[model samples]
Target chain A: MQKLLDYGPLLLGGAVTTICLAVLSLLLATLLGGWGARAKLLRPRGDPLNKGLIRLQARVATAYTTLARGIPDLVLMLILYFGGQRALNWVTELAGLDTLEFSKFLAGTLAIGLLYGAYLTETFRGAWLAVAKGQGEAAEALGLRGLRAFRLVLFPQFVRHALPGYGNVWQVLVKSTAVVSVIGLEDLVGLANDVGKSQRDPFLFMLVVIVVYLGITSVSGWGFNRLERYYSRGMR
Target chain B: MRFDLVFEHWDLFARGVVTTLELVALSLAVGFCIALPCGLALARGHRSARLIRAYVYVFRGTPLLVQTYLFYYGLGVTLGQYDWVRDSLFWPFLRDAWWIALLVFSLNSGAYATEIIRGAVITIPRGELEAARALGLSDRQVDFLVLIPSALRRALPQYGNEVVFMLHGSVVAGVITIQDIFGVTQTFRARYYVAYEGFLTAAALYMAITFVIVLIFRQLEKRYLAHLGLSR
Candidate 1:
């Protein structure tokens, strides 16, 4: 009751952490996913000699996506948090440098970003494919090429198509941020858990956390819908 | 990296995998039972819709781990007051970490399954329902004989996703001392300080189970839903 109210400032800060993690993870996922999709679609410049490099890109991206998507989110978080930190320690030991303590926020963000990147790969790839072939051909006829063609003709349209799936990924990503609590990140869930346990009102505190998440999701969903409409204005 | 360590702990890993599967299976089964009626009620869209909506909102909106903590820590304290609950034979099992994990996981998943089933039932072809009624079936008979089966079939694929999600979500059982893979992995990692080997083994098992779940769903989809050829 009154004890829980005392936790308002701490819980508010934790909410900020949750939102920050979600936003940063989403950004990283977008970057990785864009690269992954391009890698998946990478073909030679119509030269047999270029095929090897293209094949390698495609293979590397496929492996990354498969491993990221296949592993459970928690397992991935643990692997990166523990094993990745261990590897860093080993390297530092060998190099005679200071041993490192892994920051949970960084590790958690990277793990989620990597995992969701695999999902967004398919999303972006689907969006890309859904684009009209004529658009690309028209870009070529207009003397636009490579990055210019993509920026002008392809990226905008595909981004719009990617919005719906991207929204889904973002929502799931937001929820997955709670899993980051395992690493001792003071996200919303972590704060609720600590305060709940201390106050002996775990259910009441968690109920409040649930309401907070519902609010976040509702607002975000509304925002995404508005953005989607903005991007989709002329289409249909 | 440490094959010897992994081999030394074979029983631990095996038990972990078995329990993980059991947790997911039991929860998914029980959740579906709760979900079916809730879904049907929600899809009917009348007096009961608001109740089902609140259930789904609370469960789906919240993360599963907090709910697990509430069940194990919060309810664990509150329910200790009831002598009847404490004295029952079921209390022995209920006190087990496995049962507690199953209870929270089931309820959280039940909420999700409600939505999935609701969506599926809501989209049932109106023509089929009219034909069933025309054949002189009672409303209850039509629901049981025609609607539920079709809804289950339609919901199967999404339900498979839920099953796998539950599989992944069950990892949170580790927080409450449940002996699932994640829990075992944590114990192994802590005991040996060999994070790489312990987590890698568990990750492989998780990925393998995910593949198997996907394969199972694909076969089910083929067998039960080949009629919707082009849409798939």
Candidate 2:
């Protein structure tokens, strides 16, 4: 108990780091997911020559999602964290440049973002599909085009459809930040483990850590619910 | 890049594969046993439903890695320190990391399984229960002879996803010094300083296992769910 207080500030700092990592990775994931979703939803009607290129783009997106979803996140993280550094140095050496450091935080973010991007790709695609085909046609008929059409008409409906799944993905992504600790990142779990070891009472410290996680999850769950209600205001 | 290193460690990889399969299979089997009654209670609105929901929420809300560490380092080590626990007959099993890993994995999987089962049970058509009751079957008979079996079948597809997730989750067992497939990759990488080969091979193996699980579940669905098929 006394030990917990003594280490309180460190634990709080770790929690802040964990939250930052989750937010950054989520931003990356949403971007990749949007790009992948667009590539996947492409229709090859532009020209005879471009049709094959569009088909290839869709194929590559499919492969990325499938491979990402198939492997475990921890293994993927380790591969990227360790192998990425080696690959980076090899490239630098060939170009007569100094070896660059690949921070664990960056690798952790990239691996998690890439992994969840696959799931989000499906979620975003489904939401886009559910927006009613006629909605797009109506927008075009009213002289709204491309980004204007999506912003004015499509996105509001997409949020309503996507909120539930987006919430689930966010919850899981937050939990997965714990895995970054395995690679020696001083995140919440890592700091908790260190403190617990020094105090020689891991059980109590772990219980505290568990409560912290529960707090984060429940608070986010409530926030998502509010977002859902806001988006679904006019719906039945 | 290091194909030769992977081939040289083929025996270790094989053993790791067996251990990984055992961890997933045993934990999931035990988890299913734990889930069955809790799922029924929740689906039927039994008085225990509130307690079961709390259990599910706690287990699901936290990360599995934390749970693993809690069980192994936290509970296991804490208990092992007590004089009574050390003197007890159960000490032999408790002292082993394998049993601790199994216990945590089972409980974690059990929580997710309960939800899958409850969803399946509640979705069962009301008329089927009425038909069974109207035929003069006892409540227990209807539950066993109809509700349980049908829920199990209906739950098969979602449950298959759980199995793969469990397989992936079991990689944390490696963290606790269990030589599961992921553990083997870690050992090989540390020993040889080779990047990509061992981990890539393990990834390929995991993908293959996932494919096989998907195939097996598909076949089971076709066979058992034939009556519900579109062709019918």
Candidate 3:
């Protein structure tokens, strides 16, 4: 009990790092996912001038999502972390520069972001599709075009539709951040393991770790629920 | 680039493949067995529903890696300190990393399977249940003969996803010194000091396995779900 309390600040710091990693990765995933979704949904019907480019875009997006989703997250992380480090060092040495070290935090975030980005692309595409085709047509009928139409008309509806799936993805992504500890990130799980090993009471320390994870998940679940309710207002 | 190194260490890769397959197969089989009854209970709102829900919530909420570490390093170590546990017949199995991997993976997979099954069971049309009841089938008979069969069919696609997910999740076994596929890749990388070849090869292998899983599930769906096909 005294040892746990002594390590309280360290565990709290680890929890903060975990949250930061998750949020940063979520931002990266949402960015990639949005672009992937747009690329996938690009249609030549509306604009014949760029038909060739759109087809290429859609194909590239399809390949990205397929490859990312098929591989396991841990494998991808290892490949990106170690393989990426080697590549970076090779490039730097070739340029007569000092060999660079790849940060575990960055590698973890990027690997997870890229992996979940595939799933999020599907989620976002589904959400966009769920918004009635009539809605987009209606926006165009009202003489709203391009970015304005999407921002003012389609975006809100997209949010309302995407919130549930987004929340689900967020929850899973948060849990996945724990995998970063394998790469020696000083995240909650990593810290707990270290602390527990030194104290020779890993079971008790692990129970505390589990409770902390449960708390994080439960709190976030509640937040997502509230967000969903807010977005879903004025509709059945 | 280091294809020669990978070829030289082919035996390691083969061993890894066998371990990975065994881990996934055993875990999924055991997980499904555990989940089926729990799922049915949850779907039927049985008296044990709350307990099952709590189990699902805990497993789903935590990372599988954390669960793995907790079981192996935490519980396994703690139990080893006990004279009774050390002297028990089960200690041999408990001390083996493979068994611990199997136990943790199965429990994690079971939690996800339970939810998949419960959702599938609930979405079963009310009329189907009514018809089964109308046919002089008792509740147990209806569940086993009608509900379970249809639910399993409906759950096929989702369960296929779970199987792939389990395969992916089983990579954590590598972290625990299980010499699974990913572990083999790590060993190859460390041994040869080569970067891309080993990990990329493992990636290709995993992708191939996933492709096979998807193909098998597609065939299963085509056969069992033919009635729900649009052509009909």
Candidate 4:
């Protein structure tokens, strides 16, 4: 414990890394989620993309989510770290970019982003379903088309409706950032592991890590509650 | 990229699948056993119910990965040396992958299952219990005859979700070097450089398993909840 306090700077750095991973991944996930939701809602149910194509798209989306949600985040982080890095290196080689390398931060962020994007898809899709159809129709009738209607009408309601679930997803994603440590990311947990190894007091280091996580979870939970309240205003 | 290599390793994959199934089944069975009583006690507001609720909150609030590490590393260090515990007949079981995986997975799911079973038990109509009491039935009789059956119906949907969660969570056993489906894929990826193929195939297997489980859950719900104005 004294060692942890002495090495506070390193621990704080890890916490910062943890936050960066979560925030960046959350940003990417939300963007992808919105796009996925729109893809499902905007496309005509009877579009001539062919039944097989539609089924394939749906299956792909479902697989993305199942694979993300079903497997443990630690395993995902490992795969992303070990396999994904190799795959990325291969791509760089193909592109004739000799000696180019992907950093642990980028790999961790993108891996988590991809995984959480699947979760956000389900949350956003459910939120879209909850949006009253009349809300969209009213915007359409007022000459708002495509982007304008989505911005003016759909986005607001979807954000508000999705806030609660998205908050939960955000918490999950935040906790998931810990797994990045497994991938050699210098996230809070990763740093703790390093310190633990160096100091030979893993329990102390892990306890410190747990405390940091608890702090993150508590603060984020409070923030989410506030956001949920803010979005839920004017409802009976 | 290498179809022949995958074909050659089909038997390995099959064995991996079997191990994964065995691990999941063992964990789920153990989880259900512990969960039933814990849930009943929770719902019944028996002594120490508050403590049980707190237990549930901590387990539910924390990520399962942390729980796994805490068990494997923390518990192993702290409790690994007690002579009776070390030398007991259970030590052989306790010292291995199967036991740790079972213990962690069961406890984790048991926490969730408590909520499901409690909700189901409480959702049974108060009138039914009252009627049983009015019939001069013992409290135990009222519970067994009136409460338990009705509660099971109310709980089926959420319990189904628990089933899916436990099945999915079983994949995490791979992290501890248990050659479950995901573990096998990791091995393949290590040997063959076919990361995407192995992972995608494992993902498909998980989907297939989860799909079958979900379908069975649905059928069970329909059968049990048929009289409740529910339709498939």
Docking class of 1: medium
Per-candidate DockQ vs. reference: 0.62, 0.72, 0.71, 0.26
lDDT tens per residue, model 1, B121-151: 9889999899999999999999999999988
Residue A71 in model 1: shift from native, Å?
Answer: 1.7
lDDT of 3 by residue, B1-232 (tens): 8799899889999999999999999999999999999999999899999999999999999989889989998657999999999899999988999999999999999999999999999999999999999999998899899999999999998899899889888889999888999999888888889877888888998998988998899889988888866211
- Model 3's alpha-carbon lDDT is 0.90
lDDT by residue (tens digit), candidate 3, A1-236 = 89989999999999999999999999999999999999999777656668988888899999999888788888888789987888899999899998888999989999999988988999999999999989888999999999999998888889999998899888889888988888889999899988888999888888888888899899999999998888777687
Candidate order by decreasing DockQ: 2, 3, 1, 4
**Best by DockQ, which number?**
2
lDDT of 4 by residue, A9-117 (tens): 9889878888988899999999877766655555435766765566666666766676665554545555565566688788988998875666778777877788778
Show how many residue pairs clash in every candidate, following the order shown: 0, 0, 0, 0
Residue pairs with clashing backbones, model 2: none
TM-score of each model, paired residue for residue:
0.90, 0.95, 0.95, 0.81
Which residue pairs come into collision in candidate 4? none
Model 3 docking category: medium
Pairs of residues at least 3 apart in sequence or in different chains that clash in candidate 1: none
Native contacts retained per candidate? 0.65, 0.68, 0.69, 0.08
Candidates 3 and 4 compared by TM-score, better number? 3
TM-score, candidate 4, is 0.81
Candidate 3: RMSD to truth? 2.1
